[model samples]
Target: MILVTLLSFFISLSYETIIFCSFSITITIFSLSFISKYPSTYLVDYTCCKPPNTLRSPSHSFLKHSRLNLSSNLESVDFQMKVLARSGLGEETYLPPAICELPPTPSYEASRKEAELVIFSSLDSLFNKTGLNPLDVDILVVNCSVFSPAPSLTSMILRKYNMRENVKSFNLSGMGCSAGLISVNLAHDLLKTHANSNAIIVTTEIITLFYYTGKDRSMLLPNCLFRMGGASVFLSNKKSFRKQSKYLLLHVVRTHIGSCDEAYNCIHEREDSEGKIGISLSKKLTSIAGQALTANIHAFALQILPTTELLFFLKTLIVKKVFKQKNTKPYIPDFKRAFEHFCLHAGGRGVINEMQKELGLSWEDMEPSRMTLHRFGNTSSSSLWYELSYLEAKGRMKKGDRVWQIALGSGFKCNSAVWKCNMDIKTSSDGPWFDCIDRYPIHVS
Candidate 1:
């Protein structure tokens, strides 16, 4: 009798173990399914435990019944959609040797001359490529961060292009990389309000004018940092022009930091002992950028899909915990999920590395960005657009493809713009910079 009882006890224990394993497997499968569906449905939070007060009702059918009740309460609504178009207004020339290698160790006079020529040559090249009538422009937005022309860059563009009298114009000063997208956002608003209006946005920074005059090691940084860049983006509300435009304005997110005097120290324009004006960039710029990204992305993700959040979480955990490297930062979202192409800001080698680390992206992922930096240096606000053009030049974009363009500028702000590809991307013959698409994955020295 005792032997029989022991045998039965062992049999029961084995059965219980099987049941436990099956239950665990079922839960695992459920979790995977939940994650997969979370992207499409807003019902993600259900897979996890309910918060403090929401779990009071313990019926097995409570979750399903709640979903049924919510669905039943839906109301129908109709809304009209508005769209804006921004066209790549041809390519422009960049006189790198002239700006970076001026004579006399780069005194003020040489700097001034380089600045003037940069503006002149860049505008002329852009107009020629765009085949746009200069006098037809209705609004002008010109941003020359460090070197605002004496009569203003806006006036210069108008005079050279022979723009009409009553042409509305605004010159943005000292608003770094964020300025370009800000200009785009402004144009979107203006075009939406007015009918048959064309808004021209010109982004360029004549770094030659702001080139360091002193031998101060701190001042010497800009000499190595700033690069020649200028671009013209034409925006309009006309639906007919939308089909050929490279990117439709999906959404723009902007986050401003360092608003107060102390916080303003995050980024500032200051002078050296020689009274020469120089933009003092701080090492803290990266930390500020990370913070801004968190805020901007948080707001964006709420409006976007939960898949974005999950991807962000996975990338973050893998990079922060599994990698166990101090230099390694949390992963930025796999932009590939939301965008077919990426135009990350090519601020510097270090900046590029940080972005790559955070995103868990390979060097190939940053090819456009790295190439932009190598070829044009930091073109300020226009760098992201240049990267986009690089991808287009390579024939990488296909219809319905999406792009994520990110920019970091003064005020320690990080701004992002999403674009969708509508048509075949063809290489332009008039571009100031050519894409060595065949020789990409280049050795990054």
Candidate 2:
């Protein structure tokens, strides 16, 4: 009888244990199912506007125009022009009509015209490509660092599209070129909360108004660097649109070094001694950018890098910190292993060169950025899209490939976005590079 009772007790305990295990498994499966049902944000399509032919300003034309406008010594102007030509910008980049003309004073009307032309053209193309009615857009984000007018950019977009009455809209000003990715992150968060929502993000900078006629060499740099361009992107978290999406956002990392005094004032907008207003880029910009990028990448690696690469990086950190190895350099995990394509910002030749050296990137890895700079100059926040478009125009993007977009800007900020190609992207006839794709990868001195 005692043996029988013990056997019965064991059987009851085993049965209860089996019931609990089954319940846990069911809960796990249900949780996973619920998680899978949540919507995922996707990039439906993007378009970069090509400035009109009237706006095209080759290097020689720009140099001649600058000499005619500025009161600086001919020698100084010539030196600045030479620096600009060697700044990795090609001969074909376009500037606003006002800039090409080098008006005696900055023209607000000309600035407005340039902004309207680029923004409208880009949005028109985007809407046409995606067949997305503007009325369906639930959120609108517009970023232009230097040009925020009385009728805000977002308000202008809303009026142009005649969007729905309650559409959420925002205009980000003084955020610098990195504001493009910041807009993307904003849209992502909004989509998560709104569910099945669509957002439009427009990035551009108005060069006409920001153009400096002043002789301050530092202020005059913008006169040489910035050109006319803009980009518009459509994002959606609707599951029904997944089949038509081009890419899925994997991660976004942003780092700002504004707390540091030097970084905060590195790229500043102020009036020169002559009371001529312009943005001054400090000589230490490249170093500040490198530091910001390093911090941003360290954060990014933790999220996207493979375990083996992470382990190696951790080992290097341990060796440097614990062992006090003075000569050892911190390991830059093989980012090439994590990403198949790279779209480093076409900020300038020096910026791109610095990034290449720091990341140990191959020439092929830097081609898109180099080509974009050569073709478009620095379009500010829109520059990254132009680089991405170059990759597509060259037929380099493949389904499932990963692409990384990095941008650095004023406020000493570094922003990065990682995307996985969800579908094969074909070159569009109306793309920014469509006419000049064949001539690209051209040697630029």
Candidate 3:
């Protein structure tokens, strides 16, 4: 009887143990399934506006109609012409029709037309490529540094396309060139909360209102650099769009030092002595931009750098802190190891030159930015996309390649976006650079 009872008890305990183990696995799998469903942002496709050749103005013609031409100050005209020549801008860069014409007609209507022309062309191209319905966009973000009309850029887009009533929209102004990545970051955050969704970010600068007629040499600098261009990008979190997407967004880092009085005032848009409104860039801008870029990239490096690179950086930090090696500079990890391509914002020739020197980038690494600046001039927030498109047009983008886009803007901000190519992207004669890409990598003397 004792043997029988003991055997029965042992059998019952064995059954219970099996049941508990099975239940544990069931609960764990359910938790894993929930976690696995979380969404990720993808760059579906994008298109950039190439203003018609009719708008393209050669350097000499532009100088003739230049506001500085009105000054009749031979020295001032000479100064602008010299700056334009060395500006890394080719003769083919475009200007708004209004600005290209004599006695420039910069009114609300003209500005609206320019916006419509740029935004519509880009959106139409993106829609054609992706076949994405306008109403299907869950969120819309438009960043134009100097232009935000009463209806708002987002509102204007909605009116034109007749999007859904519940679509989330954001219009960003005064955010400067870095605003493109700011838009990307915002869309990424909203995508996290909204579950599966589609987003469109349009980056552009309107020159009509920003055209400085003032004679401040600092103000006239913009006239010699900025041109007419824009880009529209599509982002999605839905699983269905993954197959067609171009890149998977890995990270976005932004560094804003606007709190410093000098940084804040470095690029101020105010009235000149004659009360002509324009943005005056401080001579201190280069150093400030350098500081912001260092802060931005340092943060991003921690996330993207290889384990070995991180260990080396950490070792340097320890040496500096524990051994008091005040003379030893911390390691600047090789960014080339972290990314296959770098799209430094075509902010300016000087900015690119400084980056090439500081980061130790080769001419080829700096080519996209230099070529974009030469072909498109500075398109404000949209310049990074043009550089990226330049790479795509050059047939340089390939499957699994990593890309870095770094931009600096008026807020005294530096922002970086990292992406991994999703699939084997076939090289094609498509995008803004298709017709002119072969002519690029030109000697920018």
lDDT of 2 by residue, 324-385 (tens): 78688888889887899999988888888889988889888999989998889989999999
lDDT of 1 by residue, 174-274 (tens): 88877888787666666666666767877767665565444344444454445556666766666655665555666678777656443357556788787
Candidate 2 residue pairs in backbone clash? none
Better by TM-score, candidate 3 or 2: 2
In candidate 3, stretches whose alpha carbon ends up further than 4 angstroms from where it belongs are: 1-37, 67-69, 317-326
95: Cα error in model 1, Å: 6.4
Please say which candidate is ahead in lDDT: 1 or 3.
Answer: 3
Please list all clashing residue pairs in model 3, or write none if there are none: none
lDDT of 2 at 317: 63
Error of 3 at 269 (Å): 1.1
lDDT for every model?
Answer: 0.59, 0.85, 0.85
In candidate 3, clashing pairs total 0
Q: TM per model?
A: 0.69, 0.90, 0.89
How many clashes in each candidate? Answer: 3, 0, 0
Global Cα RMSD, each model: 21.9, 9.4, 11.4
